[model samples]
Target chain A: MKNTAIEVLAVKNLKKSFILHNQNSIELPVFDNISFSLKEGECLVLAGPSGTGKSTLLRSIYGNYLTHFGEINIYHNQSWINLVEATPHSILNVRRQTLGYVSQFLRVIPRISTLDLVAEPLLEQGETEVHSINRAKDILQKLAIPETLWDLPPATFSGGEQQRVNIAITFVKEFPILLLDEPTASLDQKNKQAVIDLIINARDKGTAIIGIFHDEYVRNAVGTSIFDIEEAKHAA
Target chain B: MTMSLQNPLLKVENLSHYYGDQIGCENINFDIYNGEVLGVVGESGSGKTTLLKLISGLLCPNAGSVAFDTRIEGLRDIYKMSEPERRLLMRTDWGIVYQNPKDGLRMNVSAGANIGERLMAIGNRNYANIRSDSSDWLEKVEMDLERMDHFPETFSGGMLQRLQIARNLITKPRLVFMDEPTSGLDVSVQARLLDLVRGLVSKLGIACVIVSHDLGVMRLLSHRLMVMKSGKVVEQGLTDQVLDDPQDPYTQLLVSSILPV
Candidate 1:
């Protein structure tokens, strides 16, 4: 039943640093020579203490951060693309078809209802509005978001509820690769377990996931292997 | 994503415009594909409207070319076309929705005429058919059937805007340029208009280039975003990537300036 043989993402010799120009051009190195490969049905938990560039690694993989050097090769559209070298259009195409990311905070757009917001990715894939909304409702219900909040914008929701909405948006349509950054950071035990179930379910369905989970309980529940940045950096 | 694989419906390369010494927009380059919504965002005086005008053939660019994939002539520079040819293309294959409905609609005509005029211009001589099509469009835009025969002067700003949309879309244009279509409206009305535009744009499979100062509108409607500053494109990327993780300093400031609700 384990479909873990196919590699979906590979990072090789990746390096990133921030240059503070206004303050005498100080160079802050985040991570260097980071390399890893993720396979289908395998959840790799990024493990590190604070400031260990765990989030940076995830963002690099998602093409949100431009790395100084190296390759982020993602299997997209039946071909492999080095995301570091891919054009903006190709990156966007990968994001739409192959990759999905759930950030720590939701960028709540004004005036769009939570249901529409969650259903948007499906609509972009050309699903009928009714079908997209129905799928959105199913995910929202699974995540325990109240039916009353579906029509309202997520901006007014509580932090946990907003995070759940954010999670629901990404999880509503399964992508080949999923990057989760503190997805359960704001949730309680019950909601945290719900999110854990979702992660395991996606993984079991052959999604390759890289996530940062501060909660050890949730990490153990879903992670197939831990990619510890601090340990890897020291070894390098 | 399949849309990107197709050839771009419109392409702008090194397009620039200058009003005397002031730069309207400089060296702008981008491609808009079928069913894609591309948004240009910047503060006032940042050349968003200028870029929109330059590409839509309202204002010709000084340096570069605006090429469109015309049905008759594939991927021809619009600036090089004969004036009559360009005008015909504008009336038949392209639509421009102005910020003010008054700028786009025939204020002297009824809402039904405003919608039917485009169809008439393209040689739909049957009155019964035109009237039926106009009424259908009014319903699609969620306007009352009774309002179809009323002059636009009697309509409110929202209603007038909706009528202008129906007028532009009646001809079934392949590409549409919308300039702040929901600006200066009530928040509720803006939301409704945004929903309507989003639904129509997808359902009709129109390639749209939208210029707006509001990032929320861009996030809601645009598939890709180009961040302009002082007439130059500082950054361009998928909407979520640009807004959530902005790389350019100007884009960072722009995204951060929004007041969180």
Candidate 2:
């Protein structure tokens, strides 16, 4: 049982910085040193004050910044990839096909229908639009998005409605590693709890989740026996 | 019923709105005192948006009246006010930022155009004045003035929302409406944005009506909350009261649903 349960994604001594024009010759270290690992069917919540670079770490993991220094080891399909050595194209491939990412914002394709929005993840992996559309509808129904909302651009939906669409896309992909950024922030209490329940449910189904969450209740809900990122610092 | 004794900047009485025989919301009555954040929380299609529209003068009420501290064009109630009067009154005291940053903004337009568009509609056409004014507001919203010439595409989601906020608050309108302002942001970004919004709202003493579904978001930013269900407000009170120990079944279900566990 122990041998079968392996990490889905692991980072070693991840470091990132930026140059500020006002501060000469000195780089502004957003994340001084950060490292964590997420196992299959498990989740780790990153909690911190604003501007502490919590979002930056997620972006770095997703290769949103190209200049970051880090060694991220992702285990996919029985093969371990040293993400530090992986090429940009390969990393993009991983992101596109294997990584389920929930960006901070609901980044929908403008003017696209809601059904198409949820189906984009499936399409990213070359799934046929007809099959993807059918699957997207099922996921949307489970997520509690109304059927009438399927054809309208998400711009017309309430803030909560738009958030549900963002979430529906996350589960449409058959990925092991899920990266979510405040997935429940727009939802009301009922929907937020439902989402948390879904994540725990998804975890049990073998999806490793790395989420930057501010909800203290969600952190405690996930329980202990975790790889706490706050304790790790620059030791690769 | 013994009414709330305290004087209110904005007052609602038996307020109701409908969409083609469908009750958008009904029997809504509340008094919003000056300098407080009144939050409205509910599920999708619970009529919170319609309530905001009615209260903000964006849509006229079908059944009741909204009385403002300062009347427009000698009209006593918003429902009875004329379009030109609403425009003149809104210019002086109403500001709104939508949930979708794109809706709150003009996406293809430059940052300057986005901020100045509203100002121009209200008849501020001096170019230098618009630039200087919008630039200072951008700084207030924690945006870099150097990127002031860029379009919304070049900006991140958080920055775009911030720009929308700057444009709304630049006028220092007395009443501000925010519909899920932090809905599409990361926690870190949400924290910063909420802080900026709360700080600015408090500093200017602007009375605000924020419609959000996030209990945490509402609790963090609002003084009071009005929990809605179906098409009516189930409960309205201080945030601590409504969220901690709700008596109404719908409100109770809502409070319980936020377990985060």
Candidate 3:
């Protein structure tokens, strides 16, 4: 296994902004001439006010936006890949293979069962359905979601159950990077700490997490080192 | 008017709402009073929102009764109130602040238009009066008057929440129900919005029912707190008593889950 403390992702002098109507651009510069690096197994959190471009910066590094003029380096296989030249499709492939994303709102397929939803990443990674289903059931049981609800469409599940399914999806594949957006916003205290413990457990397994959290309880529950997006946006 | 020391504005007698054949809450009983803030805290699916739905007359109780005497009416139970009576109360006596500000707001309409729509729903049609009233509440919620014409998409999430507040409180409803008001806001923004809601509820003497999972928020804002687990109200008491020294095991577990910052 690779050394867990080594740098995994690095960005240098990144700049990105949006345009408005009549040639007047809103120009939301999130990381104006900013440089940062993340080490393997370390989680970086971005906390800020709404519309401060915290989500935008995550999208930019994931190649969802064009970094106006900067370079990003992704470490892999004993070499650093200059992400500046990586195509969006390639970025997506890398993300799919190595990154996991969790949003504030868990997006389970409307009529799909919990087992199927959790098995998606595994199936996408070329695992057989039989193998994925077994893995899914195990995780669901471990998470304490009722076994009877496993085959039922997650639409009928409670808010906490749906979030548990979303959490299970993050663990399906051996991904290195996990991205979560307020994974516990609507959860009561019981589920909030459970989700936090789950994330910390995942980080121990060598996953680099990038989560957007608004709840102080969730933020303090996981990372001791936090990247305040409000300061980041203001400094820019 | 002197209220009886034990008089409750709204009383739930073993009240329960069932989603289809399933029980939302079992043998759930509680009493809410006028001008009081009652906080309901539970997991996402613990039926906190469902309880609010029942009290607002949005949903019918399947197993129990919601008995209340309102300032607006001739009806004893709002569930049995006539359509016109329901309309009247909705128009002037109650407001509901939804969790997703976008879901509660009309994205296409300007902020002013959103507030006007609330008035229009209640049959307020004089455009001049509506505009004046909408702007009045806009300032009541502490929102900028200049941005009244901007669509909800133009406003930030915190601003959108404020807009929803303006829309709901414009008519000065006697009571309001908030479904996770600070679910998706930043810490500072959440604190500000909570303060705004607290101040408004106090100034207007409007009773409030706020549902959230944050114990600290409930402790900071609610006079009383109800703890729900699975599908039951395991404990209910003064917010300080329940949160600071929870008697129920589930309440204690929940309190332990919260990390004080």
For B1-261, candidate 2 gives per-residue lDDT tens digits of 011224567889998888988999998998776667889999999999999888888887888899877743332576676789777667667888888888878889899888877778788989999999989898898888888899988999899889988888777787788998888898778877886787677567787899999888787677678989888998776565466545466776677778672
> How much is the lDDT of residue A14 in candidate 3?
73
lDDT of 2: 0.75
| Candidate that scores best on lDDT | 1
Model 3 accuracy (lDDT, Cα)? 0.75
Q: After aligning candidate 1 to the native by TM-score, how far in Å is the CA of A115 from where it should be?
A: 4.0
Candidate lDDT (C-alpha), each: 0.90, 0.75, 0.75
lDDT of 1 by residue, B43-128 (tens): 99999999999999999899999999999769999999999999989999999999999999999988999999988998899999
lDDT of 2 at A87: 50
TM-score of each: 0.91, 0.51, 0.51
- Per residue, candidate 1 scores C-alpha lDDT tens digits across A65-177 of 76649999999989999998887778878988999999998875467899998998898798888999999999999999999999999988999999999999999998989
Model 1 docking grade: acceptable
Cα shift from native, residue A34, model 1 (Å) = 1.5
lDDT of 2 at B3: 17
CA lDDT of B185 in candidate 3? 98
Model 1 chain B lowest lDDT segment of ten: B1-10
Tell me the lDDT of model 1 at B154: 97
